[model samples]
Target: MDLFEKAAILQYRHRRIGDPGRCVGWCSTDSQRLRFDVLCRVGDTSDSQTLATSVSTMCPSSSTKRAGAMVIFHAPDLCRPACCTPFFQMDYVLASGVLSYRCRNALYPYKAIRQMWEAATRGPGFNLLAANVFEASHVLCGQNQHAILAFSRTLDPAAELVTGSVTDDFTLLMRRRAA
Candidate 1:
């Protein structure tokens, strides 16, 4: 189908699913086309406040300027074997990265963030690290090491939890010690 046809279908589907459009964020191979279509439907009033509130409650520090739900895509065989489940998963390995707040905002907490990451990684989903290019600085500067160690003690016992410079190439893979 053409871009317009696909957008119309998505809109119809979204409406059928009770998703009011305003509060939904989509990440697809054709992001530009999707965004254009969504914007065209901006005239339709949808209360995104509730979604913003929920997101704020989970991550209180996150900016609510344009808060919305994320819809990720995961193709087969791209994620870890354990992630091959019936849940909606994103391909973190192929993702550019994620953008999150440094501190807990109104919507989420440290525990919640860790749980989400663990859950995503444990299943057939996106790689949180791969989807989050800025995680290195955000975690290191935000002292997320302590949080990580606290939540997953068995993963890194001798973690020093020191402040480090944030680099573009920073990935969670380097935080591990030799086995």
Candidate 2:
């Protein structure tokens, strides 16, 4: 099944998201019904302490000033089985509700990040993160968890557009874009 399918099975235990095969994720403007797609897992990489730390640090649960998030994100790379990354890229559109997986390529290079970022920072405490997907120094594995973490830390402290990804250790890291 696809990512959206996984989410639907996870959230609603079904495989229909807006359409049949072209689904991405779920989207809703309603504040009462929030969806957690980025936090879901598909394989052996399940829940752990590191994951909790990652989500809390990267994704802002809520803001003291604002009410909720404009966007929450994760990318499966540009290759088949897109795999998972530690970079959490979210863009929030005020009062527009959330939208998810609309196509197989929905997670393609710089998809919804741009539109959401533009709308999110229109007010205070609004932030957008950006980061480059880099290869880790390890010669044995293709896992880029460490690479993503290091990349996130190197971002500008004021970088509202940081990239978030799953760590090599199965942790999630979403922060403001590095400089």
Task: Please give the CA lDDT of all the candidate structures.
Answer: 0.27, 0.25
Q: Model 2 over residues 31-134: C-alpha lDDT tens digits?
A: 11222233222111112111111111133233311342233232222121111222422222221112112234433212333322332222112111112332
Worst 10 residues of 1 by lDDT: 49-58
Candidate 2 — what's its lDDT? Answer: 0.25
lDDT of 1 at 56: 8
**Error at 18, model 2, angstroms:** 20
Find the candidate with the highest lDDT and give its number. Answer: 1
Q: Residue by residue across 1-179, what tens digits does model 1's lDDT show?
A: 23453354345434535332332222332432322222212121122211111110122112222343232233222112222234633312111122222223422223433333343422111112222343333221222333444543444344222122222221132122324
